[model samples]
Target: MPELKLAIDAMGGDNGPSVVIEALINSLKQDTTTQFVVVGDEAILSSLFSQFELSDHPQVTLVHAEQVVEMTDKPGATMRQKPQSSMRVALDMHAHGEVDGVVSGGNTGALMAQAYFILKPIPGVLRPALMAALPNMTGGRSYLLDLGANPSCDSETLFQFGVMGSVAARVLESDKNVSVALLNMGEEELKGNDEVRNAAQLLGQSEHVNYIGFIEGNHLFSGRADVIVCDGFVGNIALKSCEGLATLIIDELKASLTSHWLYSWFFKFLQKRTKKSWQRLKPDHYNGASLIGLRGVVVKSHGSANATAFESAISHAIKEASHRLPEKIQDRVESVLLEQH
Candidate 1:
């Protein structure tokens, strides 16, 4: 009856089914029209559902999965070995007409591989990218793609990511003229490697994309670009480094403010003032990464996501689904590719 239905991999992440169930339980309250097909151990999920008083919730349904994909499992191995995993089951459901999208907090590699095999990439998409949203200084968000999907990419692949990412960003932002940039070593034209330089050339020649040239690491969160593109190797390292730095900054601030007994009271006061600022830096608030260019909406959550974080992942899937993101991206990518011919 509900137009939006999502398959959730309940047993995917570090904390297990409880977090996913809890997020689903809370989500049901806010959005009654959305249906949830939760995949995991039946016994464990039943208990969790009962514990959260969601046992008979009309919108929720539980589907059992025999095997659980581990964090360390190789992508290709998991695909061959575990066919009945929660992640696999969810993806299977999405690939078919059963569910509109999938949200999983499981092994990223396994999820990607399984999704590639099951859902497959949309026509004209070279490779699907792991695109994440970062809070920018301009009170908005910037999208960075190929976070860890493909470590190396050619100029054509990199150029495709820009087209796909811009379409992806349009789903969230109201603006169609989203700025695209290449994450480079420097702003200078000759600073980066061959792949990046060639990609820049392709992007600049494109009339479809609003190419903004190059963006340095320092300007990643400065709102210089709406969609930033790079190969997985550089993007993954840069993203992780930013996350690590954000954590360290928060830890240092907390330590400094509450180190002495005299400062404890003042620290508490300062914390209230800085809570909003800290939230922007924390990964918990923005835990979902869209696997763009896929035939279906598949959101990858942080492995260690809590209930709040997992809820954000679910929301990401729903938002993308509502916008018909894959179709929009396909249209844009085809338009760009056609112009080059």
Candidate 2:
């Protein structure tokens, strides 16, 4: 627990600064060694601080931002019109080495755009990809990348994602025997369109990656691979679809258990056990997607994430920053590219 510093975009997210402020309290409790610079409007943050009774938290500081990027804001427009935005300011802080990492539950497009412009990509990385750990059947997790960073990536870009993701899995998962797989329509060599097949070929030829062939979306949690690669277009849809389905199932189970005539001690007991079991796989509650392959660490939390979940995003930033992930990815990518040449 070294004295780590991170910047927070306090005014992002659908829940706005209130959730970020509460999350800061929770995060501070979880990691005493981390210092936070919460960026947003000064007066509003001050009011929230007073309300939370965290106005005197020595580890937390406030930085004022003049503009707030809305969920509806276009990335290009936001960049030009909202130069002083909380998202931009937080990234600026990270770029300038004022903070080791940044956490934001902001406009995904805007945040990604700002992050790419401010932090830039590692030298050999074609483009920065977003990666998050998803629960797998073996009770372990796999890292999925290109979570909407580049919705339409080329063969080479997809290939680079595989290399980047493989390095990331090894570093973040702390597992040297990590496996990489391309998400496809089928697990055959001839499956998928040109880019996917080409990327698979690239990964297969690379000694740097442990190419495990293709993995269909259904086997995402089967522990077939430790690192799953896909273009952002497919990855985003798959991730959200899975999340939506999980939420639906959990809600339905709760409703049925509470409303049924068999709602007795037995039913209550089942619900309790089920909830505990499902808590570990709850994607919405504590998921944080990191924008990887960038020069600095930037974690993107769901815009609707609660205090606990956002707190997890803060921890995610700390972990990646502490690991010097960007540098590691750079080294891996450089080696992989040189081998190709």
* Residue 159 displacement in candidate 1 (angstroms): 0.4
Instruction: State each model's CA lDDT, in order.
Output: 0.90, 0.88
Please report the TM-score between candidate 1 and the true structure. 0.96
Question: For model 2, what is the alpha-carbon lDDT of residue 51?
Answer: 92
- Per-residue lDDT of candidate 2, residues 1-341 (tens digit): 45779999998899989999888998877777788999999999999989988788889899999999999998878989999999999999899989999999999999888899999989988899988989888988888988888889988898888888887777767656899899999988999899999998888898988889999998888998999999998999998898798789868877777785676566778858888777877765447899998999999999889988898888888888888888888888889879989
Which one wins on TM-score?
Answer: 1
How far residue 37's Cα lies from its native spot in candidate 1, in Å, is 0.7
Candidate 1 per-residue lDDT over residues 1-341, each given as its tens digit: 34899999999899988888888877887887888999999998888888887788888899999899999888899987998999988998988879999999999998888888899999999999999989889978899999999999999999999999998898877655799999999998998999999999999999988998999999999999999999999999999998798789879987887899778888888878989887786677778999999899999999999999999899989989988898998898889878988
Q: Candidate 2 regions off by >4 Å? A: 251-255, 264-267, 284-286
Best candidate, lDDT-wise? 1
Which residue pairs overlap in candidate 1's backbone? none
